[model samples]
Target: MKLKLIAPYLTLIFAFLIISCSSDSSNETPVDPKAANNKSLGTAARDFLSAEAFTGLHVEIAYVNGFKPSATTINNLRNFFSARLNKPDGITITETVVPATTVGSLSREEYVKIEKDNRTVFNAGDELAVWIFFADQNSESDEGNSRILGTAYLNTSCIIFEKTLKDFSNRIGGANLTLLESITTQHEFGHLFGLVNLGTAMVTPHEDEQPDDAGVDKLNKHCNQEDCLMYFQTVGNAVGGVMNSLPTFDEFCLADLQANGGK
Candidate 1:
């Protein structure tokens, strides 16, 4: 999803309706409820990492019919969150089947419509909710052989191009489907946790430099360590751009998370 296997790196952006739920004294302007569940990416890092604000984590995994992620992947995701998050209350996941998109590829608007219509979980009480959709098609952001696997958009929302991911996983020399799913899921989840200097500031300067679509240098919001899960390896070079095995967060990432209140 990071780079097109051909030449250009497609940038996929999703703009969700923003709502600030925090209420100030009766003196400040009113907050918009319509913006509920939507916040800037990486803004909810502390809430997910630390138990200070949210003591429990609820993940809503909604998928297109017949495209539900494997149980192994789900367990892997749960384990990843449980290992890193300080949510002592508990971490839970709920899966639901949603209608499939009619399109072969999905645009930002299509993504928004689907999520708005089906997503049922949002941050409530002492629990922080995370929403993830498993789409049955490729992202409209795809170009050439570069197919998007997943994208983390709003603070608590992400979508996985499940069909495309499966296709790639079944490819010759591709990584195991479960491993690919687990890694990709964890990677997107890492974004939600604000990895590699995203929302959580880095203890050291380790953000990797990647070129934009125009070949311009930019902080592509990934880790510098190739062995880290957040590293942005070019899919064009790797077979199907999927990892052969699961990867752990590099020490720098661990430091960032710990500094931000994560275990």
Candidate 2:
């Protein structure tokens, strides 16, 4: 039987900036306190990491609009996640690749609308899913085009813009697109796991305390560790710096994850 699509009960928004600097801190909008306190985003991370969460978990990676990831790329992501999310009590990670298709051009709002409309394609409570869109996603603001690498809705789904990643890769001597994509995928997932000041309580004060020109907190939801995968300001040449070496969760990040029952 085909699964029915259910609209997301709660949509948690976490935005990532690809540029090294933001427009203005004053423009930074505050997240709703009520939404921040919502248990769905917070508890989802805890439940996924808990030994009793599920006997097995499935992660579906769908490539839309001509986005085709290589076999090596797919395997690398699986290996990276298995080492971290795997459990000793017979928990297993299964991955399936959805065939590539042309979904046509889409703006940021359109992409989001499509995800919400077809939410049933994802197993809702049954699976962890991420959709990678290779098409260009333009912003309505003056930032022009390709300013974000990806964004993840807590426990719901992750949307990645490959066109931007490929553009960045070409600027840097045609670097490995797969590596960049992997870094982005993992970084966004880190947010879902409640890194920094997100849902998970931080163990250390690694949060970026500096404010932007507008006086808004610069590290609202990102790590301050330059070498960690969850670090903010990972765009343009900064991406290469982070990808120069393998990205790993810093001590503070690991502490938070461990505290929440993650490996």
Candidate 3:
């Protein structure tokens, strides 16, 4: 009888532990919706472009007329951004190439022109105009390969990417540039929406030592730990040594989005 009673007690204890573990697991943080949203955006935008909704967005492509990039290069750049953003089918994105000689290094007047162009490109609809520039005039080394630039605004109807033929040429026949374009454009757009930073604004000397370079690609961030995308990891090199795959922002970026009600 005593043995039988002990057996029942053991079973009850086991069941209670299982319930407790399940409760703890369920209490963990929720997952991000972007992975799903990105897939959906891609499909929806592609379908929209294929259907009758194409011309209404008034998307037009124009180069500075004397710009260095061939028409085809400009087209390639536009297509890349459109596909990445999952642009709606009815909307049109115009790619305009500004001549390096005409708008060499963004000037005050040039900036004003670009800003006005931005308003025109985006219009009241989802229309966009992408402008490319080679060098900012403020930088010393053009070979630091930093020409990849653009801005995406929230209230505005357009986006801009300033690139030079030389910078474009260097990225030819590689996925890095493509990845960089998509990541930068998407990230900037997120910023226009008032998304806050995630994680530490800067990497600490200690965390810098933890980068995947020494084959420690995985990091064990504790609960309550926050990382912001603006954080710069100064110590360790990127996992693939490619800036595209590097964390332009930390994983906590996604987390912050979730906390702030971003889809």
- Count of backbone clashes for each model? 1, 3, 18
Candidate 2 clashing pairs?
5-120, 25-214, 26-214
The better-scoring model by lDDT among 1 and 2 is 1
TM-score for all models, in order of appearance? 0.84, 0.70, 0.38
Per-residue alpha-carbon lDDT of candidate 3 for residues 91-195, written as tens digits (9 for 90 to 100) = 455555543434455433444354344322432333322222322332111223222233322122122332432233244232344343343333433333222
Cα RMSD for candidates in order = 8.1, 10.2, 20.6
Model 1, span 183-236: residue lDDT tens: 767887888898767789999999887665589877767788877877775222
Candidate 2 structure, TM-score to reference: 0.70
Please list the C-alpha lDDT of all candidates, in the order they appear.
0.72, 0.52, 0.30
Winner on TM-score (1 vs 2): 1
- lDDT ranking, high to low: 1, 2, 3
The deviation in Å at residue 29 for candidate 2 is 19
Candidate that beats the other on lDDT, 1 or 3, i.e. the better one: 1
- Higher-TM-score candidate of 1 and 3: 1
Cα error, residue 96 of model 2, in Å, equals 8.1
Which residue pairs collide in model 1, if any? 19-35
